[model samples]
Target: MSMVEVQPGGASGMTMPAAPKRRTLPGWAIFVIGVVGVVGVLATTSYLTGEAALTSSSTMQNTVTLGMPILLAGLGGIWAERSGMINIGLEGMMILGTWGAAWGGLHGGPWVAVLSGAVFGALGGVLHAIATVTFGVNHIVSGVAINLLGAGIAKYLSTLIFAPLSSNPRDSPPIERFDTFSAQPLADWLGELEQDQRAVISDVAGLLRGLVTRVSPMLLITILLVVGTYLLLWHTRFGLRLRSCGENPVAAESLGVNVYLHKYVAVIVSGALAGIGGAALVLGSSPSIYSEGQTANRGFIGLAAMIFGNWRPGGTLAGAGLFGYADGLRLSAGPQTVHALLYAAVIAAGLVVIWQLWRRKWTTATLAAVGAVAVYALYYASDELPREFLPYTPHIITLVVLALAAQRLRPPAADGLPYRRGEGD
Candidate 1:
């Protein structure tokens, strides 16, 4: 109605009106959204499954404790592979770490336990280094030897050290655990949400409380190690050279990078990390005893996580979290929880189908739809899942995901290849 503004264009005096700028989401926002989405799915699943109790602060704390070892082992694998070595002996190394921790605890308490575990792990690394790096033994064979040696040594040491003390050759005496610390006020504030109807919020609050308060020293160290490893691998001169050895050791050696020395260092660090993980496992558990098969194939799972993560630290962490979540779910499974989880799976599948369709991926969308339908049918057909089968859920997920994503997965180019001083790949 304003005749004074006769111009067709706006204040800019352009022929065409300017399009509104898109409010693009920042990277951090996107990441947060993704996290929230995942959390929401988990929370809903828990609530529907009547497993909401599993999402409490205490459970989350337990999850982190259980997940820490897996994370460490995965990191160890990353270190070895990134330097052109394959460490299949992580399980053996971890076993040594456990014995070391027990020995240390017996002698000097918690601090000594950590150091002893590290030392023992380093010893294992030394043997591996000698076999693979110095003697040119096949990496897998060397690892297997280390595993056999570690298990035998642990059992022998148990008899010599712990058997007399505990009267048991298969297990060691209980060790003191590190003190758990938490902010009382914060914990109290978060604890109030324990009974919240919104399961997601309640779960988040519980996790926050556990993480912020009642955290153990070992947990802090584990987190620090993760950050430190990232910096060491990506931001340091030595790290670059070490990574180069894994990529092309021949070229690296030509460029004056001591391939053998770096390989030795890498394997040593790998063992150290694995040792820390083993110590964490002992320290995090009840009675804190080192027993036979205590590691329970966590090392293999770590290897699987490494593969799932595409050999990156961040990716490895994510993979470990997923596996840990599955483990947690299994541990806390109930009739309600299982039912909720089943429904949650169907809903998740439906969301996947919708997401694919939104992206205009017809085939993918159709597949997702079919998958969703299949999940629903499976849930409908089965009245209930056996409780015993719950323990294998994580492993089953790992196998399925790997099978589906194996084609796109890539490892360091020379990850398992032998690097002679003058050889070419």
Candidate 2:
């Protein structure tokens, strides 16, 4: 017997023509283009404003350090979201991890501190899983509750445990921090190249020098985790099952995948990663110690990064780096450097307008044109931005990035949705 394929809302055996495929650049080409564009912008800004910090090694070093926590938190967000859970409580878990790391560092050492933070964060994950998966609590409500509780608990613990040592309720005693290493001959060679200041080559040298100089072991681990996450999620059988749960739990269940187990595991891992992020913030500081409000809402920033990256690991890293770069620029080079960046923004906006026009997106092109004009006018009008507003550079960048990327994002089908076993049946 022969079978005829039936088309939906059409006669039997009828098929629709396939749509034409859109041409797109390969990932590597896109990456190279982005890198070259960024380098060129920095070079131009530095030359225009005569601010060397715009392309300095120290600035890039600060960017890596500042971006690490955000990257970790973003990774945590990815883990949870990919498994069909929204983790707004990453901040809370990070708070808990900070306390745990401080306490562990004082009693044991850096490694112990790391372990303690992970365990504490995992506990928070367990609580969230119990509330949302088993008891059917709203994910947002549970996450908010976790945030409040985590903060409260951390404060109380700080008073009870750290007050005696530090004579302060908000700060813990100093703990030993991890050591950093630099590549010897390569670092020296790159430093020399950076000093020579030969346009793009020097800028590239400076960037590489910063990466190799004073590098923390944890930073290396973070990079490994990013690459590992990509491999695991896209390549592994277990990852496929977990992602399936997020995409369609009912379908996953029918296929003998344990959706609840996958979600629980994913969320727990999420908390652990966020916890590590907290530990990174603590450890990355001079005379590392936990302090109240030290997290500075980096957890939320990280969530935003995850969204901007469209839930991919590589994209998340880029988002984190962008935010980190904005923050590092302000902190390392001050307002003069930031003022110079306005020119970069103007150029970027102009490029966006051009690209939108090329794509025949009239409305988007018009918006980009308006934005570019406004930014250019501001650059022309001001010598420097107000110092008070300078601190909010990273947050402002986050909002801007999300707004631009919002239209392009494609989240998992069942993300943030409540799930129950056998509901589809």
Candidate 3:
């Protein structure tokens, strides 16, 4: 005989038991876990390959210097996209900025260079705004036009302005470098600790040392901008309305928001930021010269970084850092250190397989497992990657990151959509 249990308050007033709550790690815990994992991977890779550069202070220093321009460009993308415009002309704006910075530096100094770069970049933004917002042209078309126009204009200006000064049509004369400061005592202490080479402790010391030593004022300003962007876009009233235009402009217009004004401002600011990025490239380099093609498609890379970050300031910084690290490794440490990275990738892939299996994603787990095995086999067979391939490492990283993050990406609902006043009404 089967016995039936009575429901609460009998059948008429039955209630189901509460479902179990899912557990998740807190933000700080997740951050700690990530840091620990990274340290572990680096330590293991260094030990296995006998490569000290993998976690050296110099490598970290180079990472910051190289990553700053990309970070600035990514920030510019964030501003325009957040306000409902896709500023694909960021590349063009940056090119203009490089020329502006060089010209300004030659006449005045570093600060003048920064200001000139911003102004030039803002001018590019104005062109974009007029084409996309005022005229209702296709955003992509407008952006491409800006890119071409920017290149042409830069070349023309260089020939007219820089040729007489530098005796070369494509190169600018030397510009003043930015002043840098360091926490010398802290740097010295960390240097000694890094020299000790005590696994995780030494690695952490090296990383900290890079940050405290020979720090640029622009780096501080960039950090402030990142924080400022987060606060402005998420916390302030103006930011809300601007973001609203991107999400639903008709509704925003109905609510008395000046969508056109906000879009124009956003795009202009975006250009200014991209211009600063270009300036950073000129000033940060050893010789402080603006050469033709110096932007090196970093604007596009910045766009990729913005997407990798899912259009957030903090995320953009992380994306830029990753790209910068790959680039720095290639430039500073060369092939042997990069080869050591293969071993670290193998371990990371193994972790991915385990994670996918735990989630019961059989296809993904199988793919990850296969990938891990394949990477290991490659590591076993190859000594080092070709030097020629090193230059593309950052781009490769960008592609891989975009692929991994594609499923989670969510752009603004009304982004890239043309808006005319009264249409929402």
Candidate 4:
């Protein structure tokens, strides 16, 4: 027997090897981890409240239904930011598209209506591109103008096409937001779940299957778009040059990058995305073209999601999901009452005072102020206990969530600022 290599360290004095050193995570990695944690919390909350299991299918359907548009729209923002432009008129674009889509889908032939919406939206995007890129108008200002025009046009169209309630004018019945994945195969899986035999695992799986869905057609399109954006931003040589132009046009011009052309392409892409988002809502969701104030600021909420996502495609997706779910809260939880109102008032006040004192650096103060004002406003605005306000509680909560995202999100170094070539962050 070969002598075993028993060194000085015998069994009793054996020294263990040192643990491997941990690699430090990059900032973006940490951000992703944070997002996962948040999702876990929501998933757990849904499971515990029985809401996760009960509303799984509907919630999943509803989220994909709402999120597809927003996600697509956010990609547009990503394009603009990547190229050092901004498109604020997405809400307006959506409004215009909605009217077009709704009129066509509800009243006209299906294909004709959908095409009408897409074509009209493409035109709107072109106009935005021209104003921003060709005219060198301020990005924010141009977007605002486009948004205004879109909102006005959409409202006018709604009134013209949709009959008034007094005139027995029925606009349309909206599409179903909730759908079941209970195909024959899935039904067998769900049947076992419905029996409640395995309380824990069954409920968890039921909730997962029910409450989450693959992005439908619209979201699928967005996925393609994100891939496109990634390729455009990081892979292609032209994309590298285009990004250079946005970050430093003067320097890019020196290097022979076509600054003007790239900017134009970016702004137009943004507009088109916004229009698609608008179409998703009007054509895909609402019964008829709604006349009210252009869907109560979906554009702004989209802005919030962009901000919350911290200017990343993946992050934006999470932000959109969060806002969509938040918007669903009131719908999922039920309407407000005096009990809710009174309790909300006290809590809001307490929060406001506490936030003023606590110096947690994450824009908590702003949230506190907004929360207090919102509580008071919501309470007084409601005359009935359960009658929903326009666009309802879900919409409002979503808006809040969006704002939080923007407040917390840290934009890339060159995100909003017009690029000055050769400078470093």
**Residue 279 shift from truth in candidate 1, angstroms:** 0.6
- Deviation in Å, model 1, residue 331 alpha carbon: 2.9
Q: What does candidate 2 score in Cα RMSD to the true structure?
A: 3.0
Off by over 4 Å in 3: 1-36
Candidate 2 clash pair list: none
User: In candidate 2, residue 135 scores what lDDT?
Assistant: 93
Candidate 1 lDDT by residue in tens digits, 276-386: 888888887788989888988787788888888778787777777777766765665554455455666677778878887887989978986887788778778877777
The superposed Cα distance between candidate 1 and the true structure at residue 263, in angstroms, equals 1.0
TM-score of 4: 0.68
lDDT-best of 2 and 3: 2
Assess candidate 2 and give its lDDT. Answer: 0.89
Model 3 Cα shift for residue 257 (angstroms): 1.1
Lowest summed lDDT across 10 adjacent residues in model 4 is found at: 172-181
lDDT of each: 0.82, 0.89, 0.88, 0.59
Error of 2 at 321 (Å): 0.3
Please write out the lDDT profile of model 4 over residues 1-425, one tens digit for every residue.
22333346345544555556778887568767765545444444444434443234445456666766677677777777777776787777766666666666565544444455556666677887777666667768877898889877765665565655324233433422312233456655764674563544554454455433333445455577767876777789977876775566676777777777787777666766666676666544544344455456766667666766666677677767765654544344444321242333435455555756676635666656676777657656654355535245545555555654454555544444554323332
What's the C-alpha lDDT at position 126 in model 1? 88
* 1 versus 3: better TM-score goes to: 3
User: On lDDT, who's better, 1 or 3?
Assistant: 3
Task: For residues 1-425, write the lDDT of model 3, one tens digit per residue.
Answer: 33344476456554555656789986456646766777788777887778889888898988898898899999999999998899899999999999899999999998898888889988999999999999999999999999999899999999999999999999999998888888978899999999998877888888888889889887987898888888899899999999999999999999999999999999999999999998888988889988899988889889988998788887788788888888888888979788888898888888888889899999998988888798899989999999898888888888987998898899888889989999956
lDDT at residue 359 of model 3 (Cα atoms): 92
After superposition, candidate 4 runs with Cα above 4 Å error: 1-36, 46-55, 103-115, 159-184, 187-204, 211-216, 286-294, 332-425
